[model samples]
Target chain A: MWRKVLTFGVLVVFAASFLLAAPVTIHFWHAMNGPLGAMVQKLVSEFNQTHTNIVVKADYAGSYSETLSKTIAAVKGGNPPDLVQIYDIGTQMMIDSGVIVPIQKFIDQDKTFDVNTLIPQVRGYYTVGGKLYSMPFNSSNPVIYYNKTLFEKAGLNPNDPPTTWEGFKEVAKKLTVKNADGKTVQYGFTSGLVGWFFEQYMAVQNALMFNNENGRAGRATKSAFDSPAGLRVFNFWNDMVQSGVMINGGPGWDNANGIFASQKAAMLLDSTSDVGMMLRQAKEGHFELGVMALPHPAGVPYGGVIIGGASIWMINTHNTMKEKAAWEFLKWLEQTEQQVQWSEGTGYFPINKNSLTKMMYQGFYAKHPQYLTTVFQLLMSNVTPATRGGLTGVFPKVRATIEQALSKTFDHAMTPAQALKWAQDQADSAIAEYNSLY
Target chain B: MPRKYVPYVLLIPTFVIIGLFIYYPAVMTFQKALYKISPFGNRSFFVGLRNFENLFNSPSYSQEAFTTLIFVVASIAIGLTISLLFSLLLNEKVPGVGIFRTIVFSPYAVSPAIAGTLWSFLLNPVVGYVSYTLLRIFGIHSEWLTSYPLALIAVMVATIWQNLGFNIIFFLSGLQGIPNSYYEAAKIDGAGAVTRFFKITLPLLSPITFYLAIMDVVFTMFTSFGIIDIMTQGGPGNTTTTLIYRLYRDGFIYFNSGMASAESIVLILVMAVITFIYFKFVQRTVHYR
Candidate 1:
C-alpha cells in the first residue's frame, strides 16, 4: 500500500509539471503612456490569458527616444527585451543597428499569417529593401484639428476647413479675435515646433526631404527639402507668425494642446493620434472640434502624409521559443478585432487593412467621425516615395536642425530661404557624417 | 593581514566600486573620444582627434560654449547673492524662524524635473498663471520658452529656484558659525553696519562663498540637464544648449557617441581648469581661520 501511494504521488507530480508547462515569458518594452499604455496592458493581459503557454511582461519604457536609447544599451549589455516599440524616425537607425531580426522572416515562415492584410501605406514606411523590418503598430498622420465653435463665431463655415496654404492663412486671419485695445485675445492657429509636421508638409507637396529618393533607394548624403516646396512651407509658417494670427506653441505636444484646449487658439496642427484626447478636451471645454486633412500649398497636388507614431520590432534574442512567442503576440495584435480595439482605444488609426470593414470600426467611426477623416486622408494619399517618408540614421539631428530653422524663421531672425538653406547644410553634414560612420 | 594593510583592505570594496563604475567609464569615455562609433556601437573605427576637431569647428559649439559660460556665471553669481541674503535674514532671531527656514528650504526637496515642470506651467505663454496675469495686468505677452534670450532666462530662473534651498542651507550654516561677539566688538569700535558686514562678515564668509562658487559652477554645468530638457529642450535656435545638454543630444539622441565622448572630455578639461583657477587664484582671498 505504501509503494502504491508513493507511485500515485509521483504520477500526480509529473501530471502537474506536464499540464503547466512553465509558460514562455517574453519581455516587451513600449513607449506608450497614459491611455495608450492602458490599452497595451489590456491587450497584453488578453494575449496572456488566451495563450496558455506564453506570458508577456509589458513595461512602459519612457518616451520614444528614451525607449530607443535604453533598448540600445540593453542590446549592447546582452539583455535586450524580446520586443521594443520604436518611433518612426528611429526606423533607419534600427535597420543600421543590425541587432533586430526582420519580422518578414517570421511572416514568410508562418503559413497562416498574410502580410497583405497590413495597410500598404503603413507597411510601406517600415519596409526597407523589400523586407519589412518591424510590425506596424500605432500608425498616425498629421491633421488639422480646428475649433468649430470658434470658426462659427468668426463667421466661417464650421463644416468646411482650410485645404490650401492660402486658404489656411485667410481662415486664420478671419478667426483671430481682438478687443478694442488691439491686444489679441485669441489666436487663429498654433502648432508645436515639432519636426514631424515639417516632414509632413514636405510630403504633402510631393517633395523628398533627403536625396537618393528620400533615402529609400540609397543612403542619403544630402538634404533635398531646401527647394521651392520646402520654402513654400517655411514661408507660409513665417507669414502666420509675422501676421500675429498664430502663437508660437513652443516645442513638444502638450503646450500647443494647452493653447487649443484653453480656447486661446482656434486651430491646432497635430498628429491624428490626438483625436481621442482632443475630442474629450473639446467636450470639457464646451466646444465642437473639426478635423480636416493637412493643407497643401495652393496649386500643388496633394502628395499625402507620412505616417508618424511607432512600430514594434522583435530583437534577435537567439532563443527560438521566445522569438516564436513574440511573433505570435505581434500576429495577434494585428488581427482585425485587436486592431479595431486598439484604434478605438487610442486615436491612432488601424494599421490592419481589414479593420476598416469590421462592424466594430464602422460603429466607432460612426460615433467619432474625426477618426474616419484621418483614415480617409491616409487612404487617399498618393503612394509616392516622398509620402513613404525619408530614411536616415541621423533623422533626429536633421529634425532638430529643421526645428531650429523654423524657430529662427518664425522669430524673423532669418528669412525662410536662409533658414531652410542653413537647415539643409546642417542636415547634409549630419547625414554625411552618419553615412561615413555606418 | 598585517595591521598596516588593514585600512587598505577595508577600502577594497570602495576602490573596486569606483574603479568599476567611475574610473572605468571615464577611461572608456576618453578612449571612445578617439573613435567614430556607430549608432548601436556595433561598428567603430579610429578617428583620432577628428571628433574633437569637428566639434571645435562646428558652428553651434561656440554658441554652446558661450551659453554655458553665461549660464554658469549668472547662476553662480545671482544664486549665491540671493541665497546669502536669505540666509542672513533667516539667521536673525525672530518668531516662526523655524517655519520660515523650512519654507525657504522647501524648494531643494523638489527634483529638478519637477521644478522645471512647475516653472514651465507658470511661464507658458498662453494659459500659464504668470503669463496670464502679466497679460491681464500689463498687456505684455512674452514667449518665455520659445524666444531666444527668454528661453535661456526661463531655464536659469527654474534652475536657480530649485537650487536656492541648497545654497541657503550652506550659507545659513556659515552665517550661524559667525560669533555675535565680532559684531558687538565692531560696534564698540564705531563701525557702521555696512562696514562691519564688509570688514568682518564678508571676510569670514569667504571660504564658504568660494566653496559654493565652485559647487555652483559644477552643478550648473553638469546637472542642469533636467531643467533645460523639461523647459526649452535647447531650442529657439539652440539658445539654451549648454555643453552637457549638447553632449546628451549628440550621444543619446543623434547616436554620435564619438562626438559626445569628445564633448565629455572637453567638459572634464573645462571643469579641471576652473577648479585649478579657483585653487590657484581665488583661494588667496579665502579666509579659513
Candidate 2:
C-alpha cells in the first residue's frame, strides 16, 4: 500500500512539472481600439506563432485613462497583468506607483539591446533619473490637418498652411463661408478643446508646462499655464470662438472628428494618429487633405511639439521568468521592422530611426506625400527638456483645470488672464494635495 | 439541523456577503479618510480631520459644493414637477393611456451611459439635428455642451428625462392606491377639479411624493455620474461638477485617496442629514391608513 501511494505521488509531481514547463502565457493589457486594434492583434498573433516557447495574449483595455485606472486597481487587488500601455501624462504617477519593471533593467540584462536608439523626444517623456521606466511603444505628435479643397476655395495655398496662430486665424477667417441665408456653411477652424490639445500649444512655444524644468529636475510644484504663453493660447481660442472663425463644436475627440468629416470646418488641429482616418475619409470625399506641424505663436521660434500617445510598460510581477519573458516581448515589439509596420499601419511616429530606412516605408511616403509632413515636423523640432512634456503627479487633473480655464474663456464667463490665474491656483492646490498623500 | 440553527445558517451567507462587500468597504473608507494614503495604497501617515479641513479650505470646494447643490436642486425641482404633471395626466382616462404611460416609462430602461451618449449626439452644437436646425433658423444653438449655464441646463435636462420615468411609475401607483371614493366625495361636495386636486389628491399622495423626493436626491448624488461623464465631463468651468463627480475626480483621476475618502464621508453625511430632515419633519404629515 505504501509503495502504491509513493508511485501515485511521483506521478502527480511529474504531471505538475510538465504542465509548468509548457509555453509561458503572458497577458498584455492595452487600449488600442478600432483599426489600430486590429493592427495590434495581427502583430500579437504573428509574434505568438513565431515564438514557440512563449505566448503573449493582448487584452483591449478601453481608453488610455481607463486602462491606467484598471491597472492601478488590479495592483491594489493583487492581480495585476504582466504588462500595460500607459499614456505620456501618467508617467510620473506610474513611476511613483513603484509597480513597474523599468525597461532599463531589461536592457541592462540583455547586453545586445541599446536604449539610445529610441527617438529623443520619445525617450525624454519616459525617463526618470537617467533610467527609462517604460518602453516607447507608440508615439504621435500634434499636426494641422487641413481640407485642401476649402483652402483653394478660400484662396490660400494648400501646400503652405499656416505656421503661426495669427496666420492660422487669418486663414480661418478667410475660409469661413456663409450661405445666402446668412448661415455658416463652413467654419474656418474647429477642434476639441481638450487638455491634451492645450499641452501641444504650450509645447510649440518651447515653454515649460510646469515649473522645475517641466518636473524633470524635481517634482512639479506649480502649473505654468498662467504664463504669457498660456494666456496667448487662451485668447486665441477665445477670440476665435467669439468670432465666427472657430465654431464651438463642443469638447471631445468625436465631435471634432465629426465637424471635420462633415466638411463643416476647413482646418482641424489634431494628433498625427488621426491622419490615417482623415486620409481614408478624404479619399471618399470631394476634398484633398493636407498635414502640417502644429502652429506656433508669431515671432517666437517654433519651439515644436511633444509626443502625446501611449507607451508600453512592463508590470513588475516579482517572478524572474515572467519578467524576462515580458522583456522578450518588449524587445520584439521595438524591432525596426515592427516599428515601421506600426507607423505605416497606425500613422504613429516610428520610435526607431532605422524603421525610416525601410524601402516599403519610403514607398509609402512617396505614394502619400501628406504622410511625410508629420515626419518632417518631428525631425525639425529640437528635442528639449521643455518640449519633452511635463511630468507631474497630478498631470491629468492639471489638464482638466486647464480645460476648465479654456472653457471659461470661450464661454465669456471669465477673461483669459483671470481664468488662467484661477486655473493656476487650482492646479497648485491639487499638486500640493497630491504631494501630501505620496 | 435544528430549525433555529437553519435560519442562522441560511442568513450566514447573506451576512457574510454583505459584510465583505458593504460593511468592510465602508469601514475602510472611514479609516482611510483619517490617514494619508498614496496611489499605491501605502499608508504614509495619519492626519485626522485634516482631510476634511483641507477640503473646505480648497478654493474649488465651495464652488463644487454650490455646483452640487444647484444640480441636485435643479434636477429635483424640474424632475419632480414634470414627473407629477405626467403622472396626473397618465392617471386620467385619456385615449391611448397605456401608450402614453409606456412611453413615459421607457427611459427607465435605458442605461445612463447610453442615454448620455444619445443626448451628447442630440445636443452637439455643430452637426446635431437640434443645434443645426436652431442655428440655421435662429442663428444661435446655445452651444448646449460648450456654454456655461447652458451645459449645466443640458445635463439637468438629461437627468430630469432619466428620472421622469421612475417618478411617473411611483406617482401613478400612488394615485391608483388612493380610494376613488374620496375623489367622488369631493366631487359630490362641489369641490372643483383644481380644489379637489389640491385638497384630496395632493394630500393623499404625500407618501409617494416624499419617497420620490428622497430617491431623486439620492439619484442626483450618485446616478447622474454616467451622464456627466459622457456628455460634459464636468467642464465649461466646473458648472456641471457634483459631489460624486468630485469624489471620482479627486480619488481616482487625481489619486488623492485621503481627500476622496473624506469627501465620501461628507457626501454620506449630507445625504443622511437630508434624510433625517425628511423623516423627522416631512414624513409626519404623510397620510397613511
Candidate 3:
C-alpha cells in the first residue's frame, strides 16, 4: 500500500511539472471590472483557443490607479506581466521609462502587422514622436446623455436636444423641477469634475488650454487656459451648480448615470464606453434615453472630445518569448475583424477605420446612429496638439487638482476665479515637480 | 553554546523574514529616492537629494503632509477616547453588554473598502438616508465631502467608526485583566466611581493605554490612505490628500518611482522619529507596573 501511494505521489508531481512547462502563460493585467471584466475574460479565452502556443491569462487589477500600482510593484519585483492595459494619461511616464517595447518596433519586425489602417486620431494618441508604443484597445470620448422622458415631462421638445451652452442652460432650467417646499425635485444636469471634459468644452470654442504644444511635443512649459474665457465657462458651471439646475458631485459619473436612468436628472455628461451599461439599465427601468454632442458654446463646431480609455502595451521587462507572444496578441487585436468584435461587445469606438464600415458595425450604427457620432467627431476634430489628449506625467494628479478646486467651489469655500487660480497653481507646481525628476 | 544557540535559532526565522521582505526593500526604496526612475525601463539617474528638495517646495506635498497630520491626530485622538469610553461602559455589568460589545466590535471585521463604500452610500446627497434625515431635521443640506471642515470630519467619522471596534476589543481585554481586588480596595476606601476610575483603574491601565496609543497612532497614520482612497479619494480639492495617499498618487498615478521612493523614505523617517519621540518622552510617562 505504501509503495503504491509513493508511486501515485511521484506521478502527480511529474504531471504538475509537465503542465507547468506546457506553454508559458502570458499575464495580461487590466482594469475591466464588472461586465467589462467578463467581456475581457471571454476575449482572452478566444485568444487562447485560437493560439495554443501562448495562453493569455487575463486578470482584473482593480481600477486604473490600482492596476498601475500593481504593475509597477511587479516590475520592481522583477515579475512584470507580459501585457498591461494603461490609460492615456500614463503614456508619457511609460514612454520615459523605456521599458515598454514600442508596438511600432514589434509591428515593423513583422511586415504583416500594419497600423496604418487604424483611424489617425486613435493611432496618433498611442504614437509618440511618430512611433506607436501601444495598440489602442478601448478608446472612448465624452458625449451628452439625456433623459428624453424628463424633457417631455418638462414640456420641452425631446427631439431637439440642447445644441449650445446657452441652449443647454435654458433646457436645463425648464427640466429642473421644484417641489411645493421649493426643494429641487429633479436636477437638470450633472457633470463630474473632469478637466478633460472641460478641455473638450474649451476646444469647441477654439481656445487653448496649455502651451508647449499642449505638452504633446515635450513637457508643458506653461498652462494658458487661465484666461477670462476659461473663467467664463467655469463661472457658468458654477451658476448652474448654485441654481440647483446642475449638481457638482465629484466624479459622479456613475451617480449621474443612475439618476438619468431613473429619470431624476434630465441630462448627464459622461464617457461613450458607458453606453452599454447605461442602455442596459435604461432598458430595465424603461426610461427613454437620447444622445447628443456635448454642449459647446453655440457657434463652436471645433469642440471635439479627446479620447479617454485604456490601450494595451507590451512590457519589455518580461522574457523574450513572452514579449513576442504579447506582440502577436496586440497585432491580432489591431485586426479590423477583432476591433469590430470588441467594439460590438463594448460601446467603445473601433480604432480601425475599416471596422467602422464593417457590415456588423453598419447594422449597429443603423440601429443606434448616435453611437456613430463619436466616429464623425473624431474625424472632424482639429489635428492640433491641443485638441489631442493633454499630455503630462502627472495627468491623473492634474485631474485631481480640478476635482479639488471644483469641490471647493461647490462647497462655496472659494469663488470660480479663486478655485481656477488655485487649481492652475497647484497643477503647475505638480508639473514642475514631476518635470524636475525627468 | 547550544542552549544560547537554541534561542538564536528561534529568532532566526523572524529576523530573516524581516530582513528580506521589509529591511531590504526599505533600503532599496531609500536608494531609489535619490534618482529619476520610471517604471518602464531606463535605470534611474542619481539626482542627489533633488527629489526631496522638490517635494518640500511642492504645494501638494506640503498640503498632503499637513492633511495627513490632521487625519492622524484626529483619527487617533477621537478613536482612542471614544473607544476607551465604550470599553469602560461595556466592561460594566449592564443590560445586554455582551451583545453590545459584539456589535461594537463587528465593524472591525469589515474591509476598509467595504466600510468606505457603505459610508459613501450613507452620506450620498441624493440617496443617503442618513444625510437626508439630518438635513430634514436640521434644515442644513451641506455636502459632507464638499464642505472642507466637514470633509475631514466625514473622514474622521468613517475612520473612527471602522477602527473603534479593534480598539474596543483591545481595551476590553485589558479591562478584563484588571484585578478585582483593586476595585474592592477602592470600594472599602469609600471612593466614588469617578475617583476609583482615576485613582485605581486609570493608573493601572496606563500601560495598556500607552500601547494602544502607539499602536493607534502608527495604524492611523499608515492606513489612512485606504479610507481616503475609498471615501474622499483626497478630494474636495486636496482637503484629504494624506501623506500615504499622495505617496500612492506620486508612485502609481504619476509613475515617478524615484520621487515615490524619496517620499516613502521621508514617510519612514517621519514615522520613525515620531515613534522615537514617543518612546523617549511619552514612554517615560507610561508608568508601567
Candidate 1 vs candidate 3: the lDDT winner is 1
Docking class for model 3 is acceptable
Model 3 scores a C-alpha lDDT of: 0.78
Q: Show pairs that collide, candidate 1.
A: none
lDDT of the candidates, in the order given = 0.91, 0.85, 0.78
Candidate 1, superposed: residue stretches over 4 Å from native: A1-20, A359-362, B277-287
After superposition, the stretches of candidate 3 with alpha carbons farther than 4 Å from their true spots are: A1-25, A109-114, A255-263, A317-324, A359-362, A368-382, A411-415, A429-438, B1-4, B39-43, B58-62, B94-96, B179-203, B277-289
Least accurate 10 contiguous residues by lDDT in model 2 chain B? B36-45
Candidate 2, chain A: TM-score?
A: 0.96
Q: Please state the error at residue B56 of candidate 2 in Å.
A: 1.2
lDDT of 3 at A68: 79
DockQ of 2: 0.56
Clashes (backbone N, CA, C under 3 Å), per candidate, total 0, 0, 5
Model 2, residue B283: C-alpha shift (Å): 6.2
TM-score of each: 0.96, 0.94, 0.89
The lowest-lDDT stretch of 10 consecutive residues in candidate 3 chain A is: A249-258
* Highest DockQ model number: 1
